[model samples]
Target: MWKIICLLSAVNTAFAGVEKNFVNFGGFVCPREEKALGRCLRDALNTYIPQLATGVAEYGVPPCEPLLIPALSVHQTAGPFAVTSSYTDVTVQGPSTMRVKDVTVDSEQQEIVSKLYIPELKMKGNYKLSGQLLMLPIEGEGHFSGKYGDIDAVVTITLGRAARPSGPDALTCEALDVKFHIGHAALQLDNLFGGDGELGNAMNKFLNENWQKLSDELQAPLEEALREFLKPLADHAFGMLRADDVLGGP
Candidate 1:
């Protein structure tokens, strides 16, 4: 029986897929399913597709921000314990001394800041989501007790289906059963033709190099340095997740 128990545990380790049994976002490390990347992705999908449903089912165009996941669950061992840091009270030289609201952690070039805006993350939304995270073979569960770095964020989107006209198309799209496939995007003939191929060459270069680059007016401008970039990006991303939950977007 002991040998069988050991074998069962080994088989559990071998399981491939997202594990939803995680206690807290902090303890993403210990669970087997949450530890694998593939499983993590599956977990995300399972959480998303269902939330878009509105009695009517649809396969094609799915709604955006369909899942609304809560950040903190009081009963769980896990924590949205967002911050657990060590800081010393010391005077700084920026032409004057002051109490710290933000400071640089010299240990790893990581600067942990207590920002002016910390959104009150509430635990309510039309849709709820919880999923596994893919941290690779890092040999432990996900980060714990904090350090959920900015990218590792919890996000939820809600879209209420007020446009239910009625048929299979509605059901298909509602169910999010629709999928998109990318074929070759045809280049415009007139634009591609040039005296010396200059236009084409330039277009090609732009496509190859600056595909992600956009006009500053089109999107947010890139900040000059690291410190300049951190606050705004973090605020827009994590800080907005739970600011207010009473009213959710459709």
Candidate 2:
């Protein structure tokens, strides 16, 4: 998520004068002046949020409204519980509503930093798990749902340039890092303990009650997943233009 924000900031610069080639990007380019770069980027991102949600097929970017993630696996062995869980066919909603609170670009260092907030996000999928929770045996294969709100994320992107045979050096994503906090979360896993309704309900209650701890435990993996997801998108967008064209002009 953090990566998404920073990448979008960089992509905004690439959109300068892109209207002639990509009509959807018209009117969304930020001014090249360093002084106005950050604010202009924030506004540009906000304006393009809707189009991005629906996707820009010409750019090979997928729709984000119900972002489809093939699978996610998490293994937690710290604290009082150890669990191995995998989710498939996951669909996430709410990123389209994200707002860029702030952005800073350091052209000299080729780094982009941004703060973003999402009002709420919901994820639904099928999950399979086996392990122990609170020293109790736990295992399940069923539908799962999660709702998260007030998500605040800080993202940093380190940019580099790649040699292009026919044009100026193209922009590349060298490294990306993201840190996030969720103000609240609610989770549910149906059909726990072989369809034991009591156990399933109790587990759901426990998960929601201790969501902060669980979220913390899962943060690293989640961040990694987000970074992986954004890298390709960033690369695809940046690969189309030269670094000089995007960031070196007046």
Candidate 3:
């Protein structure tokens, strides 16, 4: 399991409305009305995607255009195919193009739910794996690349209050859950089985032919890794202000 710590580094610049005690970042004010809050939050997220992609240096937001993960390990022990794989120097592109189809924020429930769609996503990394895939012997250390299109994702965020010394309680991301489906995917692994061209070619062909099953087998661990990866970003963005400042009143 991956553990991520949420840290807030103070900055001189302010994005939240300090005097009004409401969310007013970049002129986008979140309405206090229950009926309108969800729409406002959705719009705000869509509007901020570009800025978030490039990152806000003053606010400590990291660039996400090509989100980088140094390393990730995934294991599938109880599936049609059991495998252990590790990926390093991973880069994922296309999140910045995500569109929110729907969103609901419930302050009382301390939860936020969103349905999102992405046109396409591209990933590249160095991978090492050892195990059986589709009952075929598999062992490799190589570079891998994948392209997925028409992705749909549902995300749920559970919020909690964090006590502050001088101010009202700030919001913290207690948990993040994500489930996603890919409409189509294409994958390739280089230098499979020590560069055995014939065997490697067959394996690659088999992988593509059975992409759906492979994706299913890997979904659980992949989603878990994604949730862990996004927690800090969520925390950093939400941790700067008190709960009321963002969702209490307009």
Candidate 4:
């Protein structure tokens, strides 16, 4: 009788995947279905994508006043002295409609691929520009806040083949690689300036007239911010899940 009981226990351990339990996501749940793991994981991700609105997102550059002017001329010296921006209330637009594009798993290679689509990253914030625009020394502040549209990124994560779970429930999984990219973006600066209303309006007009140049100047900084935003986003989505969630229990 003792030998039979030990043999039965070993058999159960060998076939654990066939009778595994569902994985939990803060509240979301995914069944441990080996054949349809990709879809299950994708569903789990969509359920947890709404946690991006709890903090301030900031971007800046040293001696930033010049970042607004298009580097069109080599002899141009007049530009803003400093520029800084901070945004808050950052939330995923269209949470109901947002979805994870796809998820792929390779047990042979111990890897997972996830695609996340964000309809928009909406936020409201303010920016200040303090510097000399001309020999006369002029500075202006603007409402540099708006919604960025159609942002998406793909994350590739690798699992350790020889790694073991630290506990009975925990799984050994880590994000080996994360890549972030942005599709479309827009900015609004209609109301900028604290003290000099007339000067602010004048600066706004100039920025509106040369908006393309301004956009060009801002591309790098904008990309930097997007990348920064993706880090937390990825952590929220991928960092919470463990190896058992994706590959079943050992």
**What are the models' TM-scores?**
0.18, 0.77, 0.81, 0.48
Per-residue CA lDDT of candidate 2, range 143-202, in tens? 988888888988787878898888668778788888899888888899999899998898
Write down the lDDT of every candidate, Cα atoms only: 0.22, 0.72, 0.75, 0.50
Report model 2's TM-score to 2 decimal places: 0.77
Clashing pairs in 2: none
Cα lDDT, model 2, residue 110: 84
Model 1 lDDT per residue over 57-118, tens place: 22222332221222222111123212111111211111011111221111122112221211
Q: In candidate 4, what are the lDDT values of residues 1-250, reduced to their tens digit?
A: 9999999999998767444655655456666565467777777666544334333222121221111221111112325322333333222233233468898877666677777676765433344444443233434344455555565656676664234356443333444454445455555554455656676567666654554444433343444444444444544444456656665555
Candidate 3, residues 1-250, lDDT tens digits: the string is 1222222222212434345534554456665555566787688777766576788677687776677778878877666688889888888777778788888888878888889888987888898888998678988899998888888889898988888898788878888999999888888888889989999889989988888888864464346445654676678756864677544634
Where is model 2 poorest over a 10-residue stretch in terms of lDDT?
Answer: 19-28
- Model 2: how far residue 143 lies from native, Å: 0.8
TM-score of 1: 0.18
Better of 1 and 4 by lDDT: 4
Residue 93 shift from truth in candidate 3, angstroms: 1.4
Pairwise lDDT winner, candidates 1 and 2 = 2
